[model samples]
Target: MCKPLSDAISQGRVSTEEGERKVWAALEAAISHFIEGGLVTDDLMKQLLPRKYEHWELRSRKPRPSLRVFGRFAMPDVFVGTHVERRDRLGAKWSPQWEHQKLVCEDHWNEAGLPAPFTDQPSFLYERYITSNARQKIRVQL
Candidate 1:
């Protein structure tokens, strides 16, 4: 996990205890899924990571994501938690922390000598609760 994420959780980044719990669960789920070599569904994991650091944003203290967790796969089996953000509501608005976390994650990957831009192939957003045999890959804008 990254410093920002730890800091967020320690500092009570979210407004409600429920939100914090959800964020905590999300981070744990991310780590667990990553360790098992699986992709996290968007409902649980949203990719807000940018390709560069210059585009990062400094977030304000309002209208934040309810259960936000940011990270990237530094390697096939290695997932680095770069940052965590949580609020009373999970809005679809763009998050500055998202980019910042991505930048942190990217830096970690670079220092570790891992390849950047983790995937070159197209990404598919999969359903969250569907079983593997019943799951469907839907091509969507990222």
Candidate 2:
């Protein structure tokens, strides 16, 4: 997690305590799944389109008040979370929010001097960065 995201989580900006807890649980499950070499599906993690954003979101969609954590992959499996927001709050005007989060991530990458995020076909990225399980899932999408 980046400083801003960490602070947001710590400061209870996600929602009520219960909402925060749910989001935290979702985040932890996603992290553990990724670290354990499990196949992560789109429901838990999704890459933003247009490729220009180069952003991915970790989603927590249950228990109402869904949450989205925006970030970029620092390396193969290393995700640097930069911002988080509740889905309900974003409402229908979510594109601008996504753009803002993407900028936040890019700025963080520049400030930290991290290498550029991986940019390639979803198939290629899955093949190169993650385990083979993702190949089957991505094939259908591609």
Candidate 3:
């Protein structure tokens, strides 16, 4: 998600500095409205995770007993998705892609007795974005 709101709009062939400045300005301007009354409270189920683009916030649901398990479980957390552009060429398959970097609630889909990358949320979706973005950029350059 290399913040689609940032590079895609401001860099329609403009300087990176100009693009960052404008995007930051817009973000600053919008913060107040977004936080007026919807601020996260202590009681809210909040998961703060780091992503490449914008920060991800997972709003978990009410907890419940697991039907398949003997213990309780929380609901799947939503990946508050975002993207960020690396200042340098990144080593990942995609350097400029909006890589989903954070694991919200759903990230823990791996059963305690199981391993990673094969949870309810497939890890490849995020990785594929990186790969496809790398290929797309290559195509654009070609």
Candidate 4:
């Protein structure tokens, strides 16, 4: 789980208790599927949908209020969540919050020394593990 995401949930920064519960439930389900070496796709669960921002693949979870987990596949089975943005129903469908997170992820990726995105071809640089079905590997820091 992401620290910021967890902090948001724990701090009750969500819209409502029901929304919070739904987000947590959806997260648990996704984690379970990940642990079972399964891809959490729209087919498996409608909530976990793949979204693209340039070459980055983000996993967005639309709970009651829509909690967006911005991340990219560090590896096929490894999704590193970088930021969490909460969207209340009254807000615009799209927000600059998402763009900000995308920028943060890009900077973090560059800092981490990950392969750079192909500028000419606009191809995914982390596509090497696309076919991998490895079990969920959670990297916990003590």
Candidate 5:
């Protein structure tokens, strides 16, 4: 959560901590970009984000500034924007745009019943960069 990122830099002064906090906050901010307009992610991804960027802002060429959410756990990379991205072995960063297209996005409100898709709206990811549940307060554990 933002608190942990803050605590990571709690020892510093306002300006110092501000920068330090950014380092810690970048991943969370990225996941919360709100571009995909919904929050979603796994636990392991959260760990890798701080590791890769050390809290650096997750910028992009397109720079639409979408909400970042989705720690897939498959890759431990910190990504900003709706598309979760990662650095390849050659050190080139690759946005999981395809993966986003396939894995991200919302489904029907009710799995079995007739309900409208919520894709028109945004999704929310909490402080730890964990996506909120379909109904909120519900953790999706695979």
Candidate 6:
């Protein structure tokens, strides 16, 4: 996590303490599941499309005004989060905000001198980086 993102989470920027807790819990759960080699369904984590974004999001959607942690994979099984946002607050005019978030992630990667994200097809990403049974466990609700 970047300083800004960590600060946002720690400072309860998700509007309420409960909201913050939910987001934090979801993030922790997802990370633990990933580390254990469990398949991360799209509902839990999604790679943005068009490939150019090279961005991924860890989503917490159970509560209203779901939270998103914007980041990119630094390598197989490694994600570096850069920003946080509320899904509802992103509004219908979301493309620009989404692009902005992508830019923020890119800047973070550059500042950290991280390697470029893997921007291959979804299948390729799964095959190369994720667990072998990832395809079978995939649930495409995105």
- The candidate maximizing TM-score is 6
Sort all candidates by lDDT, best to worst.
Answer: 6, 2, 4, 1, 5, 3
> Which residue pairs show backbone clashes in model 3?
1-98, 2-98, 52-84, 53-83, 53-84
- Candidate 2 runs further than 4 Å off: 12-16, 121-125, 135-142
Poorly placed runs, candidate 6 (over 4 Å) = 13-16, 121-124, 136-142
| Residue-by-residue lDDT tens digits, candidate 2, 1-142 | 7777778766654566776677666765666776677776676667776655578877777666677888777666677777787787664635786667677777866777778876655454544545444542444554
Q: RMSD of candidate 3 to the true fold?
A: 17.9
| C-alpha positional error of residue 140 in candidate 4 after TM-score superposition, expressed in Å | 38
Candidate 1 similarity to native, TM-score: 0.45
What TM value does model 6 have? 0.74
Ranking by TM-score: 6, 2, 4, 1, 3, 5
Per-model clash counts, in order, read 0, 0, 5, 0, 16, 0
Q: How many clashing pairs in candidate 1? A: 0
Give the runs in model 4 whose Cα sits over 4 Å from its true position.
Answer: 9-19, 42-62, 88-95, 107-142
Q: Compose the digit string of candidate 1's lDDT tens values, residues 1-142.
A: 6576677666654536876556555555544664564644444434443323212112223223445555554433344565654543434445564434455656654655545534423442323222242223334778
Task: List all candidate RMSDs to the true structure.
Answer: 7.9, 3.9, 17.9, 9.2, 15.8, 4.1
Q: Estimate each model's TM-score.
A: 0.45, 0.74, 0.21, 0.52, 0.20, 0.74
lDDT of 4 by residue, 15-126 (tens): 4676677776675565566557675433332212123343333333556555555555554545555445554522453456545556776666566566543231234323
List ranges where model 3 is wrong by over 4 Å: 1-16, 38-100, 104-142
Candidate 6, 1-142: lDDT as tens digits: 7777778766663546775677666655665676677766666677776555668887777665578888887766677888788887665534787777778878877877777776555454544544443552455696
lDDT of 2 at 137: 49
Give the alpha carbon lDDT tens digit for every residue of 51-91 in model 5. 33222223221222222332222112223222233222113
Candidate 2 displacement at residue 81 in angstroms: 1.7
Which residue pairs show collisions in model 1? none
lDDT of 3 by residue, 51-72 (tens): 2222232222212110000111
